[model samples]
Target: MADAQATGPILQLQGVQTHIGPYHILHGVSFEVPRGGVTMLLGRNGAGKTTTLRTIMGLWRASAGTVTFDGTDITRHSTPAIAQAGIAYVPENMSVFSDLTVAENMRLAARTGAIDERRLDWVFRMFPALKTFWHQRAGVLSGGQKQMLSVARAIIEPRQLLIVDEPTKGLAPAIIQNMIHVFRELKQTEVSILLVEQNFHMAKSVGDTVAVMDDGRTVHTGAMAALAEDDTLQQKLLGLSLAAHQ
Candidate 1:
């Protein structure tokens, strides 16, 4: 990873607030994703992790605060427009076109016309199983393969920041291990990642920094190693004993 302090953040959320109907989902949530590293957004279910990502993607407009990517303000943009601004989001659903073959899904996501051979190579290399199943229908693939296809499709675009929601959800242990390796490989690339993950072990293995969210706001932000060492903080914020896991 690059020197985070020198490059500034790839994505910044400042006092962002959002609501759906009468229900408020985010309240002044703020954090930074440093360039070229995975920043895990750690929180339990219903803590507004997915909501925060959707708000950042502009699926829901923020009622207040600013979102900046690469120094450009994009809080008010639509989802497609925000995506065009170099932010790609992979929602928890894995949104892969199940009817389409793996190759077809990739081709459909190749909106830039010019193929990014390096990016394709990197993705395929990371998930060798994807290359092996290129001609198979995405829907017929295993849960892990679908997740791989989802991530590969997102990375096809020249994304500055990739926001992923619960990538390891509902996967077998073996598949989750493969997904962890894929994420670890992605951290070596230029693209930065903002990951919302429930698997603390996977997150700690791949994430550089961790941000703890609760009740629609970021409560703690620090290096993953430091957070792991703070038993009291881990138990209080994440309700897990990091020492036991370590």
Candidate 2:
């Protein structure tokens, strides 16, 4: 096995294909998420972005190809096994236990049995709303607050990689800005991030590298700065200018 910590992609997908029942979702999708930076997965709707993420998590098993994480092949691993291998996934739906209190939710995410006070404090600092409603039930929280809780859960415990989908969707401009700042700070940590986002402002703000999918396969892969600087490349790959999206 290669040493992911030394130099190389923390996560790599090669010729990956997935089938959801009878429907083929991903067709030879390939990309890489560098060891400790944010990688943006960009594509229009129904281009299989979400399916690719689900496939990585083992929620939807791939019919063919490989998903290598931290130098081990996780393509056939169960969801629990994959998670135990140090990957945390936050889906687009902002999945949170509605019946559980914020504190309880965080406690469950701790995974090692007890929540670390310092880590909890760190999470609180990143998202103060969770601290403000520590004992409050998640069901009663507003959408934006729920989104924060979802992210807080993913980061509460240490992991090698963090995967999030459309985290800024439906969030207010201020909330989105806060999320951008949080992601920026997260880059300083050891965890690598693979983010799927349609909001180019957030993507361009924090993405060190980017991969654009089209019809279930990655069509373009390059530095985010390169994509940001070239309007023609952005238009050619994404069908719109990243600058115009903001």
Candidate 3:
């Protein structure tokens, strides 16, 4: 492992633990997402993957340890403050405003609350549905359209790190395949991403690094290609077949 101090992980979680009500979630989870690529967080349903992401975004407080980004300690920062510091998070439950138009939803995510034509055009290229439904209320969009809106909203402006929770969740095979291409394109933008996903095909396609968590802690951290090619290890960690990932 490269020394996090020197290599500069865009997001670093060191012994982070989280507690939700009476249940202790994230028991000293630790991982590093190096700069300029996707870091796939892979695990079973009950693993602390989502908890770790929420903790990083300050949506959940860490009970112990630290989360640092770009040399600043953000473990105790407020959610809005963390967002201001350049972390954009898209949860599995796509949260587009029901009453707002697709354009309006993107405006709300903007720092100045106004559209940037170039950036909006860039986003439209990734999710063409956004362009088609520019004036339509977000609530009327289909599942895949809503998901695309959620992601478009996040990148309406530049963000240092993008943390996405299962972008392919509940989508049709065709939609999922489209998202895989979108993520592949997003990766080429050179922005760091920490993605929590169960779709191994997309994970293998876009991920450069990998982290496997179980029982509230990271059990493995290495190259995504290596994990994608090792069926035995994929089955052991995620009950997924590496052959399917390819």
List of clashing residue pairs for candidate 2: none
In model 3, residue pairs whose N, Cα or C atoms come closer than 3 Å (at least 3 residues apart or on different chains), thus clashing, are none
Candidates arranged by TM-score, highest first: 2, 3, 1
Q: Write one digit per residue (lDDT tens) for candidate 1, span 1-246.
A: 345434889888999999999999898998999888899999878999998998888888899999988877889988889888888899999999999889889988888556677877877887787889899989898888899899888887777888999999988888788888888877877889999988777887888998999999899998988887788998999888766753
The local lDDT score (0 to 100) that residue 208 gets in candidate 2 is 100
Score each candidate by Cα lDDT.
0.86, 0.93, 0.89
Off by over 4 Å in 2: 1-5
User: Please, what is the TM-score per model?
Assistant: 0.93, 0.97, 0.95
Clashing pairs in 1: none
Off by over 4 Å in 3: 1-7
Model 3 TM-score?
0.95
Instruction: State which candidate, 1 or 3, has the greater TM-score.
Output: 3
lDDT per residue as tens, model 3, 203-246 = 88889999999999899999999998888998898877868654
Model 1: lDDT of residue 237? 96
Off by over 4 Å in 1: 1-6, 243-246
